[model samples]
Target: MISENKIYFYPIWLRIWHGINAMGILILIVTGINMQFSNPKFGLVNFELAVNLHNISGILVTINYLLFFFGNILTSNKRYYRLKRKGLFKRLQLQVDYYTSGMFKNQQPPFPLSEKRKFNPMQKVSYLTVMYLFVPGLVITGLALLFPETIIENVYSVSGIFLTAILHASLGFLVSIFLIIHLYVASIGKNPLNNFKSIINGYHDIHGH
Candidate 1:
């Protein structure tokens, strides 16, 4: 149950989308690592199974990403991710300082989470890059890999598959790094579990808000 002090931070669509997106990304990450390494002793699943799971999860995540994109637009929730043109660098610097220095001292964030601006400046930039740029790049490259004979051969004069594979693997590595940072920061809210709980239940306990 949500308490009076808590504010509704996530809507139903966002919650559902986020849940599916997170699960799909996790599955993709695990399967991707297994497929990339191909070490039988350390395999989470067989190589064939990993490939099938990765493809399925990637497709599902792409669909969910579209849902998130359209849902935010329809609901006007995309504003939360809009970066402020004015003082953007300053805000980003402050946020960086807070994370690197202040956070260790238990200092409050420079830009606290709120109903209006759910993300800080840094988050806005990072999330925007990830959602709009990185995700689309990954999806396109993944699709090319999926239909290599049809897409890759015609698209590139030579080494199309190799190039596509490099791009896909590079993006996957970047997404994994981003996920690690995201989970670490999510644990740094008012309480260790505050961010996780908010995502799960929609209610966020903003201290003194």
Candidate 2:
């Protein structure tokens, strides 16, 4: 059980950014589904309206991600990947093993969080790729779709808007899959509620448990 004396951890900016980004991604996914299927299942909206909203939300999500990125940099928070210690590979291996096998046996998590290092080995790799690589790639492709003509005129050999649209959708699908896995793992915490509470109330005190 979490001790009452455990302090709150997450800052206000992280909380706000997380909430907004979640909403924006949801909107983008829903609209994307309707646009892709082009069916009455979701009562397809006007094409122009859907595209406009997608563009705006895309911008918002990109900006929110940036806020999260710089927020971490400015703080004393050492990113997961920055954890400098011997047995880095061993720690990562144990983390992967726990996720794949130990978790099913109800084993306790191998890595705990602190002010400097808040993410586990898996989280470090996942978040690093998502933030530094996939997210920026998605944003660039989305902006290309939003303004195809402008992009085509400036860039010589870059694939056209059609390709950009396909790339963006592919990245979106990948991100959606990651979200499903993330949410499920989150539910596996001490009380299930503990994961949710930590994000909202901050600190997660797994003192005795």
Candidate 3:
């Protein structure tokens, strides 16, 4: 029989970070949509307010992410981020196989949890990429928009304001796509609310390495 013991998993800080991050991303998405479709002659109805709110939310998200980074360090959760010697493509392929075939055949997950490495194979790739690539990219672009003067001073060779705006919008769209996929995948736990409950109460009763 499966164990039913309540084991501590996600900590309170992580729960707070997750909730805040989700909300911040949602706000950004709503504002982004409004800004994208604004009618210029409508007297700055959606464009002005949406862009303002989005920038505020971006600032909050940046602060929240820094706190999350510090929390991970304090809790020694950085071990989960250490990549294995195995190649990224190989590891990704293995995870894909497990999800496609093994999961349906009662086979165990290829890469399971431990005190050190709690993330599964796919999570290792996804979360790491989000942090190192997506989040940083978005933050940099947002900051450039927030302080065009300073940025232009630093990088005099920049293409132009319009080019920068294009880049920022592209990254924001990518983040929105990731958020949707992440939310859908979060629902695929032992139960519909299993993952969410784990984040809330810090326990998920499952076997792992």
Candidate 4:
């Protein structure tokens, strides 16, 4: 068993960013799927509507992402996502074990949430890769598609439009998968709604750490 303590885990700006980012990504995913698999006919919106919405949402998400980037830097909150080389793999293994095995037995996490280290080793690696690498690639590719005339010549050395589309779609697919996994894992907190509630109020109930 673990004791519980309430901590201000998220700040107001972070909460706002999280909410906007989630909504934007969800919209993008829906429209992206619709555009990719138009024959399925399960999309909520038509192809033309989906394309327009996707473009608008993509632009808004880019702005939101930029805000998140600068906010993290200005507030120094980026530290939470940093990965240290020393003992990282070992820590990642422990985290994986906890999630895959120990969690089923109600074991406490090896690295509990704290003010200094908000993310575990596994989370640090995953979030950092997605946020910095994957997201930037997605944005770059999306921008290239949006302004093809400017980039077509520059990228002509490679497959150009075809390669850009493939890269964008691939990154978007990965991000969609990540979002699903993230939601499921968020529910794995002390209470099913604990993690969700934390984002709304900025207070997370810390248990066992």
TM-score of each: 0.91, 0.83, 0.84, 0.91
lDDT of all predictions, in order shown? 0.84, 0.74, 0.77, 0.86
lDDT of 3 by residue, 85-121 (tens): 6687887887788778877787787776654557877
Q: Which stretches of candidate 1 lie over 4 Å from their true place?
A: 1-3, 40-42, 154-158
- The sequence of per-residue lDDT tens digits that candidate 1 reaches over residues 38-128 is 9868787899999999999999999988887787788788789777699999999999998889878878878876677678888888899
Model 3 scores a C-alpha lDDT of 0.77
lDDT of 2 by residue, 14-56 (tens): 6778889878988888778768776544546766677777878
Q: lDDT per residue, candidate 4, 1-209, as tens digits?
A: 22358788878978988898899999999999989888654767899999999899899989988987887788788789777799888999999999999988988899989787788888788898889988888989998888887566535467678888899999999999899988988898878888998889888888732
Give the Cα error of residue 42 in candidate 1, in Å. Answer: 4.4
Model 4 earns a TM-score of: 0.91
